[model samples]
Target: MSIEEPMRKTEQEIMPARASQITKPLGYDIYPYYSLGDNKIFNGYSSLCDFIIEQKTVVIDGYVGVYWNKLITALKEDLIDRGYALNLIESKNYLKSQAQLNEMIAPFLGTEGSVWGTKTTLTLADYFNMPALTEIEKSTSADINIITGCGASLSDWKAALIYVDLPKNEIQHRMSAGSICNLGLDLQKEQTEMYKCFYFVDWVVLNNHKKALINDIDIFVDAQWEDSINWAYGKDIRKGLEKMSSSVFRARPWFAPGAWGGQWMKEHMPQLDRNEVNYAWSFELIAPENGIVFESSSFLLEVSFDALMFAQNKNVLGVHAAKFGDEFPIRFDFLDTFDGGNLSIQCHPSLKYIQREFGENITQDETYYILDCKDDAKVYLGFQDNINPTEFRDTLEKSNLYNEEIDIEKYVQVHQAKKHDLFLIPNGTVHSAGAENLVLEISATPYIFTFKMYDWVRLDLNGKPRPINIDHAFKNLDFNRKGATVKQELIIKPSILFEDNDFICYHLPTHKEHFYDVHRLEFEAEVEVETNNVCHVLMLVEGAAITVESADGAIMTFPFAETFVIPAAAGSYKMINKGSERAKVIKAFLK
Candidate 1:
């Protein structure tokens, strides 16, 4: 079968079903582990046999985290059956030696120790010998030249390029399970390089496949080694996205360890492998590190969250789509410090500063909604009335350089955090969550712009001093949010906005700078929620469980600590409490 011929046939086989057939709530068993059945084209080895017979060369550029030998062997065996000779090219053969990589990254390393700056930029060409690969492609005599590496750049030799996409969670899972080797690279540097690979996958590979070579690619598979595999042609795969956008969306949550990690998530999220040291964060809705799940009859498909934003930006963001375009404008993540230490004393940049410095559309304006906290837990916010700016700067510098434990209380104010306290942290306000707190950080989507000023003079989990950005902090910090002003404005007091027979809505006031609003929905039976052309982000903050039903009759349940999104296109939905006790949900949406 020719590639162009199979394209039309596959489209007919996977055409979008009617709205009713596709909008049903997926069974609990249909995600993260399930596999869609094999076909001749999608997620199947037979899909590429024709390519091996037709093309003189093929390249399989994939992440180093994958089992490349197994995948390549499968392709080679299939090619042999089709009476074609195959020559294998290993990317590792061209990698710079350990000493060379270390020297190349030396300038980016911090002077204090082995820590690396966030701006350490490395490209795929920097790590792999692409010139050598091009030469091999030109000279190879085999019927098919299978070039396998992290295909971070587009090349003509990559005729019929197929990206074997894997979620970041699964990549870490393979790493932690000892299924893949780390190649003796610094963990931070490895992560940095992997992120660059991801950028290439999304930008260079996916964009070209979905746009330029929409009908030319062989297969794009969502792979989890042997457990699951899903494949689709570029065009049919895009049609699948349209069906998914209007439905209830959930991203695969990824857990990672941190210096100030806690056991809260390890105890709560049983789906995670708890053998690890600690789980500090659940990247619940951070699109960069998250993935959206799509289910078919036999298998579940997973793509990066940004794929949905790219395909259906207006459907997901609704009226706010113009402002954010393909970027999802809100973030929801857990900051677990329970039985751990405080977060770094930090503040996010203002909009102007973030745009000029970090090239971000919006700043990380944030709010800390206390989900769970120990009795003695408190939040350090703003500055004390008598804090001297010069003294504070000098103290932080000394702490960073000389490891001095300057009295934090002398400069920063601490406020008691309760079960439902909402602390508004607009950009430029210094803040940190104290020990023994489970903080649900609801804020604008721009997360990585945090400028840390202090870190309690302790080393990071990697046994190195974390980078401190005192100059950035001082430039963005708003000292006027101090003394009584912090208490009056930053510490939000919730007020009842509506009440009925079975439900009560309490408005949690946001800062003037906040483009979104947070509301606590306390209910015994049910509550009618309108999308109002703005998407709503929901968290089961104080509940055993609840079910969200769309107007079209599609429904999905949410348990405690679970994060779910309702696209503005879904219009209206109902939140029905299923537990015996009353349920409380923290809902954030555009104001």
Candidate 2:
């Protein structure tokens, strides 16, 4: 496929250089990776050279590959490359091994283990001392400098710096290592080893820094501003680059969740400070160095993710992208069957269907993390003791167990789900987490691609029967495996606990592919906050927090806590306790 045209910010909106300022250019690099057949291909241009020639005014039009090189060459020969200079980047021979390929490419990436700030430098430091020499930048006063393209998914794209773009009426998701698509994502997930950039944590994003720093855009970035609820006093705050933020305040406090938004604000509100207008964003938290703050009692800084996204972007950018997140989100999903969705009768389609049509891959694996239930949640997993795919389909069709127009019983055996249970359901498994209970769903795509067997004839949210993909699913459902799930328990250390007046927290990395570190916290403050990750999403089952911060340091504290969210690029910030007792919260890394 041709490179998607680069989305460009209007030039007229860009700040003009001072008449007396030097017009020199700077340079950097951007690498693009694609695959051909089972083989992998790598290419990039003199990112440094291009930056120099593009000078101060440039559009990140497209990637420079074999074809792009020709365009650059033509531009250079035509003399239109005047302001935009580009040096060619050499290509290395393609290696035969995947491990070796990663090795060769790793060096060009952001420093590994570098502590990319996930919150306002000022605030994060106040609560947790530098775990390592960390990088913090102020969203306001910090000079803009670099720009580069970051690979989607994995880790870097999540916690550190994620790009924000509105969703089009249609989206073309890359599939099978950029090799093929149309294989409906449900089936393709197995063929492609797609992984998501863990969404809840800040570390993954920090590791995936690939873009150049830009100074022209003065928008403040902070994790705390995602909600109107405040953070604990001195919650993790961030500053840009090296400068300590001189101001802290909320950019958007009116965007908290709960239906009582207006009534809540009317009671615990403070007059808006015009001096902080230019420096405020709905989500960027700012609190001045002197300690003065601005906020409200009804903000929802920490609430359901979709609620926060709608509130923040709509108020600030005046645009609405779904709950997909500020820029990109690690949308891993999981499917479990039992009585919840008809299980025994349904199945998934095979690899061929996924690759040719569904456009799905790696991120689709289903894992079950059970919370509670009756004698544990009984699930329909795998094929019944001895049934093969052929027999299973026959039983389903014969028993009238497979019908979209009428309810049918999926005769697959049901298993139990205890706390912390782990069930890896591969495709073709007519299994589902069938018990009614609280369970954490994990996977790559946020979709329900089930070939339902029976739903007890339950109507969908729209009061319509949910259609079943019998033909496609039966082909993919795995018949080789069956029975109950397994669990691997780890000890919870005392060190992971964090409790205070504003919140509680716990973290553990270095456990698995650095996939994630669990975090749990609670808060009730009107503090400004910022981070370097896709930001944090706090599920508020209990208390609340109001976030308050500004690019120039205006503290925008909400009176109450609702679920809240944080973005990766957020700069300086803080969270102030506004209620009685400590509010509880949990933070998960989306690495």
Candidate 3:
């Protein structure tokens, strides 16, 4: 009789050190093997796919290895009997370190991306409003501080990094293999007058204000292929940014003619008036046919953030592009709208909700930063102070939220936004910049794959039904928060402000993998900082700052303070604001 005793469930055990999973590439002579039950061995064949198939059922517990030899031998014997001589193949030690596993897989991320530009001089205090950035150490929802590559310039680089299959680009592959592969970069070295000799990379990394310089094509900036690859790695992505200083660079407002407004916004959101907009610019390396756009419940405005739309391509992930950590592509915009479309609202789905419904393909989380605003520029941030989902939905369907009479801020928290105002909105947090307003939105990579919940009785110009995923909305809406603060409100201390300027250094407050938790250094003063990790980004907001050297011959300066990055290997650097106004900068570091 079967045992009638209580069930005995066992947990998996930890593994002891092993020689497998070494630098040896797939199909290498040194194959992986596992021991199973007696006479039930299996083979970890050379081919990665083959090894996976052969070891499919093998238990990998260090204490309970599944035999792999016998199984492979049996399969081989059968193949031989059938007159087939198996061929053995293996890859070289192409992998430099365990970190390469992620690098080898970057081709799986997407090609298109979106990001915002500066109005005047963006300050460190304003970065909190930036869209989300992916962090391998921690998600935006999670308390982590690490960041990877920013998408503000992702469009400018993605086409070269993705879509075109390199192997098929026979000539390009040869050039890359000879010129890029095996060709290591000397971080301490210099090449041409304007370029670094070995730093062949993909993107010219920068912060919001510095990147805005791209709007003026007349400026001749040094770029190379190695830096393009630099942009591919999380740690190295910040390499070239060390020299940026925001103090003296002239920042053209987004509203300036030829800055990508007027004719642009006129066609998309006819309601948008050129005068109301403070500034606009295209940060995309190359513009897409449709330009950058974002959606809300009732309002669908051609967003201010720039995006380089990729032609249809394969799935690629930049999980390891940032060698130091993983970061998400987030964008932002200061909407200077004249009317509050009764339907425009802020809402997002949760990770759990997206996974359960749309799987991994749909990832989203967003936040907003209120910039300059008029007294009447109210917004709908989060749900009503006290809300009953059922009751709210019942009224929402009736368009009560859409009635122009409904002052959205009264339902949530209404606050006027002056320069340097900051707000943090996590995913599932129901918030919106409401009608008749201007606000800076900082958020995670803008992937509209989320399941929408509500669209305030709004329609496209064609007057057709706009899609809504209410069930998904309810799944992620964060009902606990309202207004400017995130989940647990952080008390603001004036000490957080940079001296003599509105530059703010509110802690990003992240806790996860050790790489992204290092606190941020926000400032515009003549300050010096030592590097601890391999990467860091110093996004410049306002003014010009130069990196200068000390009498000890150990100083480095970023004279022009636009958004810039400093690599860990850069040693020590100092910043000096050349502008009459205070400089704004963020010192993001790896923990």
Candidate 4:
């Protein structure tokens, strides 16, 4: 059944030198950045109170899982000190019944893995009843009328808007800490609601200026960065905020635990709360849930990653802004299964299937770049040459019905994994990384359209069986990706592109269906690269460190396995190898 049992015929000759041979540079933990505290914020709550009290009707909207009571308390305390009569209206009480909320989310809920699918397919505004706005208005008739909720709006009257925003991770943390409570809301559903809220907020800030203008708004309170909240006001505040994020930006990473999670992150990411069972996913650059951290001298301010894109999409994304508008089209994440089990055997939906069924614009075309792996590590990909469509479907169905383990070796081809091996996973290709591997997943923006055919016969962390998607997976699975064809196409053999004393660039070929390409630069001293109207995402895959110096003289140092982006406007930048030994950097950009 296996065309090439070892996958690579001459693997021993092509394997890179052991990564342990490389020496890590001193003080290379990505610049040793510090967390900025409360005093660094430009404007405080008092300033927001002063600015908002000057207006008539104010609408304070926020993310779904925000602590509205705490925010209202802060605002009320500030306004009370100034001798102002304020009537605060809460939005949760205006929400429809639990039955209505359940009905609205039913379309997005189904069994996928051990966890249930909890994405909110509809808009946030659709979750509210029109009559609730009347109730909110009826209760607000004091010296200052302020309405607050996730669904708060300025549609009724010409009111000053105040958006109370929080980072996605912070909200997730609060949910985990039981500070923000929704009875039946799981983490997946909570995240989906917040992401949809982000879409709504981004659209409003970018397109509907007169209705809920960002610049004309009374205030914007961001509580994601520091222990204390940040408030920015004034007519030119948008310009100032844009300037704050104009130079360098990094999104706050969010981590989650899963059944097949590993111990690598729990051991390395000391900043994370290590008490969790195991850390599975580190959402580094998924902008909807990610937040941008702005570091100042005394303090650091943070806001949702989309906020900057909403305000300065043209400046941040450069040329691609016109094509994608508010959408950021690249994603980088970690899939660490070191000392753990294999991932579920899965295939992503095709472009037509994803758009028609899931309402996504792009398919999940992915690649796995092995950052680190053990000697026995392997990856399951493609299919056996002897696979039969009818038998495969019948076996999968019988396994689901009888709760039996799958004979994976007979159905899927396995490949030996090594450090820096690039595996192309186009849509409809069956793939999964085996145990003892630290995989850096660089792929298209879409992340959640995976149709898993089989999971090992083990219950989820919750002691429930994972759902098998045989029918849906069969519809999108490419049966032609088997035997020798898979070896020739799915696996990449890097070809020498450019070589010199300073650097040697190798082209990691991607599938023809992939719009992006990857290149690895092995350098001794330094090298300069240009961005020809497309953004480049950089990752320090090997060695200790590398420093990327922009044309404007901004130097950003990256440690091992750190990811960063260079905008198209960056023009030309020099990457200096900071380690004593040779360094390897992977560059992914549009073709």
All models: lDDT?
0.69, 0.30, 0.31, 0.67
What are the per-residue Cα lDDT tens digits for candidate 4 across 19-129? Answer: 222233443221122233233445466767776778856888765445565667778988888787877776656666778866665555443222223334455455566
The global Cα lDDT (0 to 1) of model 3 is 0.31
Model 3, TM vs. native: 0.41
- TM-score order, best first, reads 4, 1, 3, 2
lDDT of model 2 at residue 471?
Answer: 59
Q: Cα RMSD to native, each candidate?
A: 8.1, 19.1, 23.7, 9.7
- Best lDDT among the predictions, by candidate number: 1
Greater-TM-score candidate between 3 and 4: 4
Report the C-alpha lDDT of model 2 over 303-401, residue by residue, as the tens digit: 112212222432221211233333223332112222233233454444455433433332233434443344645655554455566665564454344
Task: List, residue by residue over 406-481, the lDDT tens digit for candidate 1.
Answer: 7888999999999989999999999999989999999998776678888888887658677788988999999999
Q: Where does the lowest 10-residue lDDT sum fall in candidate 3? A: 58-67
Provide TM-scores for the models.
0.79, 0.35, 0.41, 0.82
**Model 1: lDDT of residue 494:** 92
Which wins on lDDT, candidate 3 or candidate 4?
A: 4
Q: Which segments of candidate 1 are over 4 A away from where they belong?
A: 1-70, 87-153, 156-161, 170-218, 224-229, 233-236
